[model samples]
Target: MKSTTLSRALLASSIALALAGCNSSNSNDGGGHTLPLEECKTYQSAPEVIVLSDNENIERQTITIGATGDMHGRIFAYDYALDSVDVNAGFTKISTLLSEERAQNPNMIMIDLGDTLQGNSAELFNDLPVHPVVDTMNFMDYDLWVPGNHEFDFERSFLDKNIQAFEQAVISSNIVWDKNSDACATNGEEVPFLPSYQIFEIDGAKVAVVGLTPSWVTNWQASSPQNFRNLDFKNELESVRKAVEDATAKHQPDVVIGALHWGRKDGGTGVHKIATELADYFDVLFMGHEHAQFIERVEKDGDYTADQLNISVRDADGRPQNQVEDKNISERYHSANRHESVKVIEPGSWGWALAKAEIELYKDADGKWQIFDTTLANRTVADIEEDAALQQEMQEIHDASVIDANTQIGTVDGNFTFTGHVSKFGGDEAVHEDPQFDGATNRLYTTIHHAKVADMPLVDFINQTQIRVIEEKATDHNGNPVKVDVSAAALFGDSSNLTDGQVYLKKDSANLYMYDNMLVATEISGEQLQNFMEWSYSYFNTYQEGDITVSFNKDIRAYNYDLFDGQGFTYEVDIAQEPGNRVTITSIRGTEFDKDATYVIAVNDYRFSSTMVPNGWVSEEDELWNSADETVYAIRDMLTEYVAETGTLSAGEFTNQNWHIVQYGQTDAEGNLVGDKGALLKARETEEGSKLWQQLQNKEICVVREESRDSDITIAVNYKDGSTWYENPQPGTYQGCVH
Candidate 1:
């Protein structure tokens, strides 16, 4: 079971490469070169073939199913630094584990659940003529594969080419070519992109493997609809039902297994609900998408009654009903039905683990194979030794990526550190004051303030790129070249904290990949613009008079924080105000605010697709431009080009301070301060006060302390409409300053 032994075992089998169809030419051909496109078009044209046979005389048979999903381009074992030790994970180790299992049972079948082509630096090889991951998968000899939603991240042509490179069967029951396209039709019916399912005859047992992908691919922000315009993603459950029925009628297999790219959560999709309702049809369900490891076993015996499973059932009104459980199968019964035993397993993402389902099948007197028992377990990569040969093979790809990542794109004059949030919270002082604030000091906060609350160099850089792109390609409704008046940007992911005065050489490109590569142009009214700012301000909790700290709402995600550039607008966020009323636009571009004016805005796809912001600020109808070129021009690339064009970059040239915060309260009838205004002001001067002051300085928040002898502790806040009073409040509760 050692990795060295596994490598030798794998090398001894010449059939691996031939079976995977990775060899360019036939094994008998001396060239051993990859076949040309004309000869390798086997995506859907190949029919199912029986590869193994089962002995009827044998009383029982066992099959091991090793499953992996969301590998995300991780080809080698990597050392992940945890709190105490380094944990290793990757396909290199997984290969050894799987090899040991296959050696024990030649009947073992390996499946990849999907989401394999995207996520890592190695994915850059996707555009290459021969993908490295394809080579690795062929080396590992995967039995079956399913396409995850991320597979559509690339154009149809690129995806199609990769599919043709796979030697094993690629199955997806729900994805089909456009029905109306006569070009892809066969006998007037739309042709499928891949086979729906494949029947594998392993030692005489006919096992049918069906694949299902998420239907929400069309709605994912990262996915471009135009890229998949030729395909349609059908409802998962309905597709599974149809595929199961078709496969059973055609093959009448001994067991049916599902390789689903959907996860357990609802997430605007009914994946979990559908999978539960149709549990009986699948002997084992291998799932992915959430990137979490889970194993569940559902069992039912002859003595078990349906009532036990229906106890928590709800009525149409969403209330618990006391009626007797119905035996007849209905949608409600289907929802509550767990009549048959089932087992579901999901391996964690990034090759951290593998899900193994071992099933024991018994041949009855009638010669029919039935599942006698089933067990599932998740094996972690941390527990296994890596395959040295596999690691050596992947090292070449990794070294190439490192070379590409370190290629000097441009240089910066000043340090562009990801300390925006930390600087706002007074850096180390904030963490020292309250340990709870430590979580906010991580990478998520580094660029939050720079991109969300205030104008910083990062947003300015992205905005400049967007503006340039929009000006070059965008047009108005009249077909006239349109100019973007304002640009919006957001920080998409975590990065290594960029140090001050550090030169951003080619080596720095890897850290900059988190921001999206494409830009989107859209139109927005002045009112919607204010609403967008208000949504950004909603990240903070209301500042009460007695509160010791100013903190962000725990419910808010750091990536959701966005800031606007291009327009010189000054706004104030009165934390004492209500959620939607927190942001007030005082002026725009040094002029009076006009609610009726419409402006062209450029933003990234992530911000453009966000629905968490209220008032429907970003709608598909308003989108005027999107980057859909065959060669992707991402924000990082733009930065590189900009830096190359202009020798040096400076934060001083890009940073803009147009917004601030005003913490005010109401005055009593006697014109005296009310509530805990005094106590809160005093707390702001304490060790906790460091973050408050830091935030005030970082946000340019103006605080006027008019020392008065008035006994009532209240603060007065002035508004464009009228003056209002704010009082002490608690967490999760807010009090509006009257307008």
Candidate 2:
């Protein structure tokens, strides 16, 4: 009953709702392989450093301990199907390591800190059994294990079942069980699981092992609230100190061992603080949480004052000193009072290794020595392997779910594995053969290029809504095909210095496909993406380049620089003989669009939620259409697909065209220079300044189709009519028109 409410204190109630209510009846005594777990409080001789009442004159002792973390169901059976996965391998590794150590001295005990469950691909399609993990742990002969935050990701009922399965002590110092509530309590009344701490003795040594877990586990784990109903995770170091104090005053234990799910030393603020601080109270800390290998003591060999006491234990936090702060272990040794300091150990996660400690008595009490009589014994490393018999027994249980590599969620055409950052958006030349660095050649370009590929794709959001354009699930694109969500940002800016007489590659004959555009390059995210968004509307001139007259409905955020005056674009009265396609403003949004009507955004869907465009956006009323989904293709994909099937791409060329740094105006039907045609032409011409111009003449290029078929097309031309030696009807000027 007490432990029930205590567990609730571990997390907020809202979180518990998602994880299922506390006290859900569920137990699987470890794959029907039940073992009688003994709770021992004594060893061969003497109470393992027995804690007596605080008579103000208690002898302090130094002890050794081992630790490991984040085994994550290595020994457990969350999913029983994969033949290659050694579910029970955790037991073999630890047991073997333990056997070898016991032959040497036998005071060492193995500790598992946290994350005993969740995070496996197979757990998705099967009813995960918590017992296999425990069975494996039991095989290793665990001294202590804590319920990690991941265990809470399951429902309260699952936690309950897992708790029942564990024959070992499952400590959660903060979680308090509620006795009054039948649901929270065990059966008719017996509450499930154990209290926070337990005392054990071995080799005539009395050690009190107290368990603790990170309080923040509630934030990430769903079942945290329900499983830990009414439980409270007190400040770790303080709680351990108090618990030790109480135990010493009552039972007089010699040493306090902390089996903490709480681990620090990572980038996180919470874990590191607890480990460094709580070190004072605990003689040995077997920690988990941030998965790291444990060392009885992390030594600084160079320049560090080994004997000097550090003002603060850790670099991250400066928590208030422990209640026994001022009480120095060294000073307490005068007369009957003995001296003792803390020893901490937190080992790595997973079933990778084992942490062990050996506590030895001081050689001479009267000798003046800054160093103690403790040292770290070598740790044990083991591989996760499969037990042949166990594997056979469980073979039928999971055979069907183990999917072949080829049959995994991929398209019939073949799995479209991501090549690199560059291939995703736009295009680059040459290195495309194998952008990934193959170790043989040590070229700096390949090394740097491959290094950038290590970045993972980020899941972006729009006003809290998941951008559904990115396909989250796997399915074949057949019959009426569904297009993958792919979008791009235009790089042209207001102050771009583009001009005419430029060249760009188009399909050689409008039939071949190509991705050889110079302006097109990936690294489309970060600064590049930001620059495009920031100056998105900067160069959008009307018929007149000098006209910098556009109304902003709201203050928009731009990425390149700040919202500068005139956006660095010095447009003048350079009027062209002909006009360019710039929309003439008549009336705008308020009266122009229907109040409740939806708008179709043709740009890389990101523009819908971004602030780059001054046009206030309306949500998609029904279904949004991207031409890639409607029998059309993005310029790059079309080329790739065309190449893949037809064995030939539409002919094209690569060239970096100039941009519109300044605007040029063109005369409209009113015979007046109404918009910036030169700036537009400048950008287009520069874009075509290379082999791209020749490719364009051969008529080979494809672009993302607008949502509407009638959307006016924007194309860049040579501005010079080609000299045709053939029929007069096939004019050379409009030959590369991208209609």
lDDT per residue, candidate 1, 117-202, as tens digits?
A: 76555444544444566667777888888989877665555566666666677899888766665345445464566778888887
- Give the Cα error of residue 152 in candidate 1, in Å: 1.8
Q: Which ten residues in a row have the lowest lDDT in candidate 1?
A: 730-739
Model 2, 392-428: lDDT tens per residue?
4333223322321112211112111122223332111
lDDT of 1 at 99: 87
Question: So what's the TM-score on candidate 2?
Answer: 0.44
Give the whole-model CA lDDT for all candidates, comma-separated. 0.57, 0.34
How big is the positional error of residue 497 in model 1, measured in Å on the Cα after superposition?
Answer: 2.9
Q: How many clashes (backbone atoms < 3 Å, residues ≥3 apart in a chain or on different chains) does model 2 have?
A: 107
Give the winner by lDDT: 1
Supply candidate 2's per-residue lDDT for 312. Answer: 17
